[model samples]
Target: MVSSVNNPAIAMAEKPPSLEKEPMADVEVGIAVTDEKDDRPGEGFGEVSDLKRGLKQRHIQMIALAGTIGTGLFLSSGKAIARGGPVGTVIAYTVVGLLVSTIVFAIAELSALVPLSGGIIRPAEYFFDPALGFAQGWNTTYATAMLLPSEMVACAVIIRYWTEQVNNAVWITILGFLLLVSNMFFVGVYGELEFICAILKILLVVGSVIMGIVVDLGGGPKGHRLGFQYWKNPGPFVQYLGISGSWGQFLGFWRVMGSAVYSFSNVENISVAAAETENPRRNIPKAAKRVFVRVLLFYITSMFVVSLVVASNDPGLSKSAGDASASPFVLAASSSGIHVVPSIINAVVLTSAWSAGNSAMLGGSRVLYGLAREGHAPKIFTRTSRFGIPYVAVLSIGLFMVLGYMTLEDSASTVFDWFQDLVSAATYVHWIIIAIVYLRFYYGCKKQNISRDELPWKSPFQPYATWVALVSFTILLLTGGYTVFLHGEWDAETFVSNYFNIPLIFALYFGYKVFRKTKMVSLEEMPIRRFIEIYQDNPEPPEEPKKGWRKLNILW
Candidate 1:
């Protein structure tokens, strides 16, 4: 018997052990029927997780802010402009941003209620099916494992801007070591580091936007008041692939969708560490509700500013330097005769790369730990140190950081790029899975006669928002490599990278089902009411009123 002090749900005397043990059974369909008469708090959907809750509300907010602002925004937004013109780029970002907002809300609702690790994966098992949970869990872990080396390689590339005398392998080694060490500490340490990096990134983006506006108004030494001149000349859209008229413009706009998705890849990471968060029911929702604002200020507005100062036709935007030279902000400043901008942008982008790697390490390890807890992964990954750090999982994921050395070789570097593309496609599939799981959670609540208001927190724009995101992301996934299908444009790498993950996910799902015979969790058996009882029994303390300086710290 479990103590009520540790878990209030176990205090219910009338509850049967079968209700608690069934969902975790491996061989047969586990049906967890809630006892309507026994209103006492029930044990949460699963076993009591052991991960420590060291992340505060501020840490949650900062992680959400910093996680998504990485190389995609700092370096690849330029590629978006070159592929799609200013108008097209902005539109694609806005559309994807809105859709991504829905995803954030969907996950937030589930995370607030479940408050578990593994982002949507844990909830996927409870609300959808164990097979889906197994599939997406591994998919996320694989993508995040690949992400570490990719970001480390980007760091090595950025360092070359300062001095190529040092071997790329040296920088890769240094960055990988720092990331591994950082994730091995307590969760607070990682949160504090990300908090500081997020502030720096926010400052750089705000400063760049202000600088862009000044340059557009002829405030720079160039003295050319460039008010929307690029828009007029490039004519709002590019004629992609030498095609003419609206069709070409449409293709260009469609192409930007992938880049936009990549730019916003990890925005939903706010809840990935839900079990390690303080007052998660409140903080996760707080961080999630602000996603649209962050998307507008950091992404859409910055892309709009880039459009004003940098022309879509600028050759610099197409440069393959893979450093600050390829950033549109750097291009704008250089064109305006501001020489110091390259070093400044390079410096911040380097930190962004490192920060991204650190985030990947944390997210990957936690997902692996969650898999272990669910019996999907080896039990060794479940080991944790005295600090409540999953050191074994962290070490396992850190081993992949060695992949950064692949960049030292020419042919291996090309292979690394293919892996990066595969990760990008996998990101879309992850979002699609989130939507599916949330929809199931939504209908499960309805099927069991649970009210949205009864949840710990409810996200606005319910079933409609999720439905739209589902259809749109599905279309984007199918057409991700459409160019390869066109005449005279058959690149095996692009075709494979874009479409390979589809079959791979299906195989994982079916393989797990065939081996384990796990069935789709029926709505009636979902532990929604049990989870609600836990939420009601264990109430988090109300936030204290802010006074003076504390009130001013609203950035979180």
Candidate 2:
């Protein structure tokens, strides 16, 4: 039942409402049923979402898979192997993967209960402080804006691998135009394209792993077995910065943690467009539960295979080609005298870059729309086309594509590296905010004597998992620029890139807090019960069982 008291603090100032006492006859399911006369778009759930619920179960699953399996894994893993060696690289990725699993569970629990746009940003306002909501909303927007241009620049570099005669500007412009056009139409258009791209990426990753095994077993044209020879010769860890000792090996492992963060950057974006997803309470949790398995299967397994087939000291791993030539899989295949791997890996990696840009565009625009809904941004961003596309928000973020032109003057490879560091730092900040918001939500439940069984979905390791993630992400963020502190290793660009987001988020948080005078919502007054009531009232239909050929399809 929609409570007559819109303000949870006022409703619970005296005592928590008994479930039996609340009326349910007139309560509408799924959407808010408030009596207030606010006509603003998305002011409350009562009016129904103006955005189309065109995303199906498969679309949500593929988007979750597509967002994380991009240029981070395709192109950047080479750098990780170079700096950390085989064993160190695996350790870094494994640690980050476990932390990311906890984040997925925390967000899944929250998004399952209150599946709103802007992902965790909307919940931050109701469960924690409104100022926090504003800060994270803009933090995500800024990060996504920077990400789009980075992907566009990557697309240009990928094109140069085939031929250098064509100017990089030409590829950037073409790719930028395609990205803008794809997001301007109905969201289903974007979903379908992502579905196709995700399938291609899955195939490529699996194919590369199998090929790596073949090369390692002396099944290649060269007939040379390379079973852990690199690890034995070069050792299990790198002596980073010409330092020679166990300490240097440890630093090498720690350094790869940042690169690991970049590889796993957008794994939490699965629920960003919750309002546009059909039966999100069911679909979101399903996707979240499967994410851990996907990470292990697609990421860790690939890294293990790459380590076995390719040496850590391969000169091509550090090449500035910014294309398939630098991919560890491509390098391994070429060394084994296999001629077909480069062209195939290059084709898929190119699409992966473009797909990453498309995802950033969609995510950034929806976040802007959610910010406008909560009055954190200008109202103009709330405007949508008749097709339910957020046109104004799309155009606002699309303008950032112009940043890709910087590659024309400077080296494309250099520009791509700059964006990699900057975006990775921003991603750490984003994950930190998610952990904080989840902790607040978890405590809010406890303070009110609400049972975890009552929630739509309760994650496995509450409070504890989130706590570990919070501390680990903070350390990573602070040490992201540690190389600059070493003797004769200072780089102004590196320091600024790693540390800039720290101050930017603080300024946004306190600025909004002081100006708006928004107070933190007390734990006792959190709206957990109200959202629980909504979930109970809205019962989704049972999923149909798969049959015939569909039964074989388990990827989703």
Candidate 3:
């Protein structure tokens, strides 16, 4: 189970030993991750639970919102509209939503049962194909590589609203620094900050939806209810899924899908956080059950309302090509004849970007630590601050923030665009792995004689749903690139962008296998129970590190 802000929760199953309660003065410098093998935090990335479960309901509230909101919806929504038109896009979203929900439910059930820090990806090694785990873990990390910049660029762009007088790159630099600094402090602070920003993100999206609804309902300027005027006026669906959708349009949805993919990059955060929650068995199940509700009520509901209020035919819809300027949410607010609302929305959306960047940094860092703990990465990444924060991983992951800012360079948009496309395309590859993993999970349950009653939460439509998800996801990705072909504006960029996903997936799998000579850990060799037993030995957490400037001594 891993959460990422500085590094989203990267919780793995393991045990604890008594923490060193050194004086506060001695603990401030930072903790150096040693090769200690007593099954503590650094016992080869054993697990993370250094802090208290002080997060309130609001924290969970924002985490879910932050997970779903941000650059994806605000910026990517318009692209979906342009491609799918009103009808096709609407249908696509609904379909994707349901399938994703099903996967989430399955993830929830397994996570509640396993409660591992590595989340679904780690468990893939156990429940599903071990090869599936390698794929998921590696791709998840690489996806973050692409996604981190996507978010930071959006954040930089959003900041432009406050002061257009300033050059965009300046904003990128500032925003990048802001997020990097946050990560340096540690996961707890990162979590708290993300908690606040996530809440704001939700409020902004939810509030905007309510506003658009009220205005559309004849509550705004001149009693002119916007209603679904555009929907009907344009004839239900403006674009057709076939010839009506066009190549350019349909490919556009892939971009939006990329953003949506990012929103859920760490969807299994609760599983990671479970290892750190005050009470694992109790808190985890509750969070798992609630995750579905949060997704529907927040993400789908907000997107649905916004799509309704603003007709897909609107010119603003066309411009959104998913660039910050193209965000339909901001444009629609502007169109409503509400001036301040647009700026306010922009400000909040800025939070979404910054918050997302925060999540990226947090998640990526833990990934580094996880890999290091597994002996897949360098030992340096295992070092932690005196406060139990993984310092090296934090800094290593933060390096990407600087590179993320480079994408903001105007001259680099093409390169950035390609990078973005490549990143988004990774989604199809990822979901495929997830599907594969789930498929394996089903058989693993049966082969291992694990019963439904033993499951903490059981996904409905199993076996069947797993097949449906895998098949549909494959079709969507296969057809996705065809949209570009249909547009007749096809080029290397289009083809490579759309097709590279498959190769990238293999590259990671084979590349790592060759280097590590890694083989799939099969059912008999799976270490799930071994990991759980280790943590069971020492239950009491180490005392909090003392707070001081020079006294920082990180326990690596």
Candidate 4:
């Protein structure tokens, strides 16, 4: 709809007379030609354009699929089951799935209407408060940077299941190089890479479920009919931290929430790539709607199947392997005397970790680029190459990939635990901020006498879903580390990992707020009417109708 001023942090001072008469083809998407510039607090950077729109509809769809499946599902699953028990684990994941899907739906409505590049961070600033966006942008950047190393470490650790002969450093170095090289290319290459990886993950989940069902039905090499047999033995619930009965089972279920959230961490990432995607207003909504189904099929169903096929008390589920070898799928296959399945799962999990690393790099770098465009970060981060890759931001994030080497010193499982705690908390904070931002935008519309039905896409349940998810996520975040308070269970690492992000986010938000002297804008000043005009002016091109099988994309 507009040029560089898409980010209200940096408003346009003047528009060229020709802009009103120019056709869409004659104008560049975000490259402003006017000499006039706004002198706002964050507006010193010259006219800035968006990253190239190289990712297509298929790329977006597969990325959406891939983001929902990661090391959290593949490796940490056994841990979740071990802690939460089979039944408790399933229930925890199901509840979290509902909460996360609600957040996704709310974001879909916001992004489809505005279609900005920074995802939640952009909306936070535009409609709520600029300080909130500053905090969220960096929180996302930091969390994603941390996740990159975590994924890289996961890849390296998975390699160890094959052989300990090679040093972990060697695997980390080689894979880190691949990760950097992959991001250095055009954005479409990254899209294609993720598409292929997503397909492999999907196939892995499907094949594992089928194998699990067969094994449970006494169709495997060993004729064992495990029709909820593990449920009977393990008794369907774990007593975590020596707490007995219902309370322990509840704690067990609660522990799984962090892991489940981690598993679904990046599902909201489709919007992070909005600026680089074609027809984002149309494609993003399509991608977002599919995120719910992908989460259900890949995460919910996989957890149920894994819990059924493997007993939570199995000794082989031990964390000694520190990798996917401990995954419930591998444990079940190995226990059933199907030795080959472990290696197959090992390979697929390796790709899943690497795919997640690539996706994190892209998402983190884009957020940094967006931050720079908004004058929240140094302008150097906005520098792009001829092919439109943000080289500076990529290199900045790539430097943190070295954190993967920490696995060489500590056990991979231990390192993974640390990353998981930090990331899970950060994920909660980010989601909480999303709820706040969405509520502000929603109420701002009502306050401005704007109609929700007039928006490009509107989610059901309105402000009610927003409030439910907001309260639920806040409660989850506060209690994420409840176990640390048990009589003998006081762990500094665990406490810091779970709660550090709360204060950190607060500091970042208020630190920016005080330094910038930014005040929360009232609904009247949110510019809701102006943004609606922008959306109306830049209506997305009509999407080409899908062909025969292409229509099945909705089933993701």
lDDT, candidate 1, 435-458, per-residue tens = 999998899899988899999899
**Where does candidate 2 stray beyond 4 Å?**
1-48
**What tens digits encode model 3's per-residue C-alpha lDDT throughout 1-556?**
1121111111221222224532111011011222234433312222443433333344544564456666556766775666555555555566676666666666666655554344556556555433445565666677666667666766665665566577766777777778777877645677689777776776777787788788778776656777667666664444434444455455445445544554454555555444444434334445545656666776677666766777776777655233445667666666766667766766777787677677766666665555554444576876767666667876766666556645544543335445545655666666666677766666655665656655545777787876887897787667655645654556788678768778767776677666545455444333344333333432324335567763563110
What's model 1's lDDT at 44? 37
Angstrom error of the Cα, residue 546, model 1: value is 1.1
- True-vs-predicted CA distance for residue 105, candidate 2, Å: 1.3
Question: What is model 1's C-alpha RMSD?
Answer: 5.2
Best by TM-score: 2
Clashing pairs in 1: 9-42
On residues 1-556, what C-alpha lDDT tens digit does candidate 2 reach at each position?
2132332222333343334523322221112333232333222244234687778889999888756787778788998898999999998998998998889888888988877777888777778776787898899899988888878888888888888898888888999999988999888888898999999999999999999999999999999999889888787899988888998998889988998898888888888888878778888888888878888998899999998988888888888778898899999999999999999999999999999889888889988988887778897998888888889999999999898786563477765556678988998998998899899888888999999999878888879989999999999999999999999999999999999999999999999978876667778777788777666655566788998999998877
Distance from true position, residue 16, model 3, in Å? 20
Tell me the spans in candidate 1 whose CA falls farther than 4 Å from its real position: 1-49, 409-420
Instruction: Report how far off residue 409 is in candidate 2 (Å).
Output: 5.0
TM-score attained by model 1 = 0.92
lDDT at position 296, candidate 3: 75
Query: Alpha-carbon error at 449 in model 4, in Å?
Result: 0.9
What C-alpha lDDT, on a 0 to 100 scale, does residue 111 get in candidate 2? 84
